[model samples]
Target: MYEIELLINGRPFRGAAEARTTLADFLRHTLRLTGTHLGCEHGVCGACTVLVDGVSARSCLMLAVQADGAIVETVEGLAEHDGTLHPLQQAFRDAHGLQCGFCTPGMLMTLVELLRETPHPSEDEVRDAISGNICRCTGYQSIVDATLAVAGAAGTEGSEP
Candidate 1:
């Protein structure tokens, strides 16, 4: 087993994992951070999206050992400890961007990175950003609207955990 150490949700974590262990498994099973879902283990689906070192990445596509010394952020880290939602999350809720919720986590994380890079992304850009993530429920216009709403609102893209 390879020894790994990383910062997750602003907290340090140390653990041992097999080389083949997916980062998603390490977060969900080892650290008990279940916000990163595993919809498609093949990585086609973005259900396992998370921020690694400030960039959105597919947790299932990365090995746990590859995350050693990296800073990881999951959906759980997006809100304040007092339960205040991140602006993106709030937008999602207000715009009804989520339906079944299976893909919400991934959508949130992906948009988080997108907003960081492009604070005021256009509708086409929003759609491009979420192309990798599939939501079987909503028509996706709501999700785009939600992202645009957040982009248009008071900036909360840089909220700290």
Candidate 2:
């Protein structure tokens, strides 16, 4: 067993994890943070995406020990302590960006990084950023629209044809 320390959703978490434990397993089974879903464990599907050190990463592709001392953000971290939804979350709801909800968390986490890197990302850019995630429902247009809605509301919407 290896000792691991990580800051998740602004809270410091320390625990013993096996060397082979995937971050997704660590988060879900060990920490009980079930927001990070596991779809394709091979990292092909972005369902296991999370923000590690502020970049979108496939949690299933990373070992728990690899996240020692790293700052990780899960979907649980996107909302305010008082329960107010993040703008992106709200936009997703308003735009019907999710249907089955399996892919929402990963998409949200991925777009969080994208919006931070490019505050005014174009529609195509939003699509590109979320290309790694697969949502069997919603057909993706609503997700793109939701992202654009947040960008426009933030006054940082970029023009893309």
Instruction: List pairs with backbone clashes in candidate 2.
Output: none
Prediction 1 TM-score vs. true: 0.94
lDDT of 1 by residue, 49-149 (tens): 99999999999999999999999999999999999999889989999999999999999999999988888889999999999999998889999999998
Instruction: State the lDDT of candidate 2 residue by residue for 128-157, as single tens digits.
Output: 999999999999999999998888878743
Give per-model TM-scores: 0.94, 0.95
Backbone clash pairs in model 1 (N, Cα, C under 3 Å; residues 3+ apart or in different chains), count? 0
Clashes per candidate (backbone, < 3 Å):
0, 0
lDDT of 2 at 114: 93
Candidate 2 is scored at a TM of 0.95
- Which candidate ranks first by TM-score, i.e. highest? 2
For each candidate in the order shown, give its overall lDDT on alpha carbons. Answer: 0.91, 0.93
Off by over 4 Å in 1: 155-161
